[model samples]
Target: MVRRRHTGRRLRSDESGFTLAELLVAMMIISGVLLGLMAVQTSALVTTAQTRQRAQGTAVANQVMEQMRALPWASLSKGMHASFASAAGGDPNVTSSQLHPVADPSITEPLVTSTDQTTDRAPLSGAGGSNKTVEADPSIPGFTYTSRAYVTRSAQTAANVLTLTVITSWRANQTTTQKHVILRSQAFAPTGGCGDASNQPYLGACQALLSGDAGATGPTVTVAAAGAGPTGPVTTPTTPIIPGTEATVATLSVGTAGVGLTSQQATAVEATATHGGLQTLTADAAVAAVATGGGRLTNSASNDAGSAGAAPANPADVTGVGSASPLTVSGTGMSLQLVPASGTSANLRATTTVSCATGVPAGQACAASDLTGGGASSVVLTTGGTPFTVASVAGGGSAKTLGARFTSAAGTTAVGCAALSGPGCLGTSVKRTVGLTSVGQGPWTGGAAPSGLASVTSYTDATLVERGLSQRTTAGVTTRTGTVSYWNGSGYSTLTIDRLTSTTLVTPAVTTTVGGVTVSASATVTVTPAMSIASHPDPVGCSGQGCSVTSDTGTLTLTVTYVVTSGGIPSAFTAAASVGSGRASAAFKAAPSA
Candidate 1:
């Protein structure tokens, strides 16, 4: 066959392969099919990896539960459990750190391997990836897991029942799949609610204790050294149970023991590390609701591990109490001498709180400046999660919102980097840091710690806050008042925190006439924090008092008014009132001054 072109050129059958338009169309069709296939394959691979990891997580959680069951009830109730690790790199036999859900050049492919099951792990810094397959050693697979446990008293549930939740976190791939498989169980008072009819050794002791039987010889109860060693109530006869004083102690009561107890009732005494009032619920002995991993939040493939999990307590105090006094700030103006947990808190995302004593304010935080001065400075950050809104909500959904001052990823720097942080003992075996910095149009000028930081984790009375005034140092310290305590979660005894202010105040005297009479009046203004530590409740005391912190009421409003004097009595003037606004928080004192 022969085909003639538009220009009248003739093409023979052998010479005619195809027209340009036809060839182009054919290529496009083939490309579309190939792309579709590729997409399907990618999806399948990701799904397969995710499913495999989740299954492994479930198994690990179950294994932890088994360990808890066999452990002495006292040890389980202590609530200190080790975190599980996953195999590090290619060598499937030894376990290292389970990679965080961020791309790491060190890890070949984030997967669960054989050694990841609690025993075969290395440290956080030792793993890099290798080309290995689970098929080679059936025990080795690509999925990795981290197991965490949280044991606490069930809310409004029985006192004898403890909720043990074993959490398993697994990562299939940083970009694809990461999930937590939770397994929960309830451990009852081994002595059968301490209500068992049998004359159990503690039965008599519990009856004597609960019945207020003055004649009863009570069991010896003791608080571990600052509450480090504690033996719960359900131990054997020889190791009779006792009470501890460092924490809240709850006791189990028998249903029939109170007024109508035909016999001595069973009971279990328990203690835990929560500062709130003791919890008492009258539910049945075995009543406990289990989440069993049902509650889940699957990241949108874009959320990084750092942001995916609950943000670890915000490390905002720029200053530490080295050998000096504790850190304090008055309102948003003053900066703390927060020592880098590693070396320098360079690029860590943080905000200075003015009105946020108890917590941070919504749109208020976005307006804060960075920590600068001293040895450190506030470097500008462009990328990170927005912490608070104009309404002061961490996960903001408010009428008013304040954009973060420094919100660029490029601004983020690495902490403890030899090249970035410069020499000295840069936390090699101590901490992990992703340093961040931002100046963000801040009015705050940061400073350095006067003394060196503690060699280890130690709590000090160093953080001190003076009431409202206008100076960072004791020079301008205002009226020191009020007793406040903040529980710093890391095993420290309750530390006393005083509300101090570093902001200056001005009061004015004015005279206004209402109703044709000369009047002399002075406006009294008392500064109340738009938000303070008392305003919000946080069980986990932290440095920054981050996300979960409640929002602050916007603006401190001072009402102004002049009263009308009728003869000798002062009458109110509604229309003559005046209103003014100030910062939403109070000044906080950080230390005794370096």
Candidate 2:
């Protein structure tokens, strides 16, 4: 039993041997390792979340900015607000007021939309909220997010350049994490470049800044250098005279009294109004002296003038011969009668004479004579003589005169005529007369001779006319005939009868017979009067009222009577006529006078 008890004690000691300190130490080590692992995981998760949040926030910010940029820049400064829903949320009902950050407070109240009303509430207090948050609201049932954006003007220049910052915050594993993103943006006035007055200085600064060494820091300003001004003119040096050249001088003089030294001597003379001190000389006196020494003078005189001689006068006399005298002769009756021609068988003769008041020239003489029968009938004469000739003649029969012709050496021609026998038949005469007459009616008989009538005449005996009409008519017809006579100078020659008809009259059908056969015939006739207007006013004067007949007695109608005879017997008769109104037409000048 004692051995059993000891064994028990050993077992109990083995079971209770591990102390509390050792146990506590082992627990501390395990806890530290686990805490370290947790910390590492937390840090990694926070970094990843921050990066993700930052990326998301940056994307959201870029989207919002793109939208705002699309709007006119003027709208931004007017405090216009725009709502941007997170893309992660399908619905635009959920919102976050912390979409803008605190760093640049210019963006006061940016808008946000979300599905959960609680998520859409402001994340912080006041106008805009901070960009931080814990777990996503369970009410939203989606990842919760906080975002903030801010805008700031660049201090470098007055130009409308803005820097935008977006911060996103959210809870991850019960720890808050924040991410930051930045972007640059700009708003422009309507004018393309910035309108700020201070931009000029800023531009200079920017140029200097760009040219500075890498990593340079400080204000940049450039200064310009200065310049200089102007002066006067330079004087001319005197020219030196060369040696060994001859100098020649000339002087002239005039004999006139008041001619002093003239401007002609300006190169040689040196005259002054006051010389040395006291005396003064007149310009005239000086000029006079110069003129006298220069020998320049003038003299005047008077004389008479006469007209130039006239051309020689034309001669008063000339020597030449004049034209010869013409021959003259006269006679009466058909036969030539002359005292010198008593013995001549043919009494007609031609004579020519020549004379010279101025004696003939030494080598020339005049001669003239008459030409007789044979080939010498033509006369040829010499200067200072006379010539004559007798020509054979023939008389004109029947009391008509013959013509005599004479020709001169110079080709002058003349002709003469004898007397005529009958009165009014001296030269030539012609007469004509016309007469008109009617002849008795008769059948035209053709003959070789003209029947001694102007036109053919027709004659009809009462019985023969009736028989002719009956022969021309049909059977069982009775006939009648008429006769008319006209005197044609040689007693009562014959009579011509014509049937007249009124063409204007409307006719009626009449039956007649011819050659034992029945025949039908009709006639229409009209007669227009040849009337005269003795005295009537112009038609225009009576245009409204009908014209008045000035001479009614002169107006006459031509009556045309129509007779219908059957079987050579008169059956019915009608008359139609027309007369012109005694009215004158409006006078239109037939021809205009020049």
Candidate 3:
């Protein structure tokens, strides 16, 4: 039983808790392990924060570098300062101030600020203090960042190398850390004796070189001089080079193996030596003395009659010598004349020889044969009406004949007119025969009529009369006097009838009595008789030959005498008549045989 108990106890003890020292030892070991893990986590968090701070600092440094690069190179020179504000939510109470270089280091230093110090202290907020706040906001705390840039010059012995160093610093997480970046650049500087120092427009790099700075170097250069001595040690004398001048002068050594100055600098040195001679020098006068040529000049003045001298007849000819006693001169006068020789003739004659086959007349029709006179001696018509004298005659031909009625002027006659048919006169006073009365009249009935005339009862009469008498009546007789008298107690008859003659037949009468009661009438007659008729034969009836013959019809015109009569007396008769159709009858009269 005891052994069973012991076994049970052993088992119990095997499953039971440890002793005090053993538990203490285990607790110590666990504590060491937890402590080591906590340390590792803490270190990781701090390293991450530091890395973040370093990245922010690098960003700030880049911003500064960009700003400097963007500025004009002149503004980036020494003693130039600038201020910048932080971005939003980015240290509102802090500011950065730049400290521009003024001396050899040629550096720019930037300072950052803290919020509390910058807001509370006015004097401490100036650019000299890094805590100065460019933008102040109460809600957020701010910290300042600062940077400084330094130029590293090349070694005086080396001409091709340049170096620069930049240092950036910031405060974060209660600690200050810094970053440094280095840059190197290179360029060529002018060498040889040909460089002119005065010709160097940009003096920054050169000045830096001469002053032993050698930072941010530029292009190369050489030196030359207008008048330079041979290689030797040259000494500047104590006495003034140009007397009585206050200008400062110096002598510089130029050698074959050592440093030398540019040509422009040598010129300046020489000019400085000479400038000591003059007290007050004018550039214009000095330049003018060396220039060439003077300009042409003239002068004019107006004069009046009463001003100073007497007036002359011609202003242009008012010379010192009088015109009446003109001075003898070799040149010819203005109005010289020369006459031609006395026996020389002034006329000029031109003869043009023409070949003619025949002689032609003036104003006459001509043919090609008329122009075939071969070499006839015809005188040419002159423009001035001077007769042309024929010098000689040769190769004469027969003269062409002209019209009989044509003639020419006396000098040397030529044909003037041509024989050609023209208009001719038909002759005056063409007479035409016409019958005065018709032979057969209508059958007369119960009326007294002449033997050969019929008592035409159906005759229509158109009569007209002029009541003036050509003769004047006196006592009981009619006389050829100008005055006309009416019958009163003067024994002059009121009515009288005379036998009708051609002159007394003014009141042409047509008498036709129906029952013989003296039906006598007078008429102003317009007589038109047919002088000629133009005939056209009509086609025969449509039958064989020997059918009834058709008469030829024609147009007839009449020429008749018209008389104006009045008061049963003759007055005047007109030679021409106004006659038309139906005023008389269209009697068919047989045409006369040809």
Q: What does the lDDT come to for candidate 3? A: 0.21
Best by TM-score: 1
Tens digit per residue, CA lDDT, model 3, 261-317 = 011111000000000000112123332211111111111111122345422211221
- Tell me the deviation in Å of residue 435 in model 3: 99
lDDT of 2 by residue, 431-496 (tens): 111112111111112311122111211211100000010111111111111122222333333323
lDDT of each prediction vs. the true structure? 0.24, 0.22, 0.21
Q: Give the count of colliding residue pairs in each prediction.
A: 75, 65, 34
Against the true structure, what is every candidate's RMSD? 30.7, 64.2, 63.6
Rank by TM-score, descending? Answer: 1, 3, 2
Ranking by lDDT: 1, 2, 3
For model 1, give the 10-residue run with minimal summed lDDT: 253-262
Q: Per-residue lDDT for 1-594 in model 1, tens only?
A: 899668776878889788999999999999999999999999999889667656666776787666555443333444431322222222222233332222222322122222222221112111221211121113444545665444456445576566655556654565455555656676655545333444232233222111000000000111011111132122322220112111111111000000000011221111001000111121233533211111111100111123443322222322211111111111111111111111111111222222211222321121111111112111111111111000000110001111111111111111111121100010000011111110111111121111110000110111111111111111111111222111122211222212232221212323333333323222222223323232212223211121111112211111222222333433221111101111111121111100
- 1 against 3, candidate with superior TM-score: 1
Residue 225 C-alpha lDDT in model 2: 11
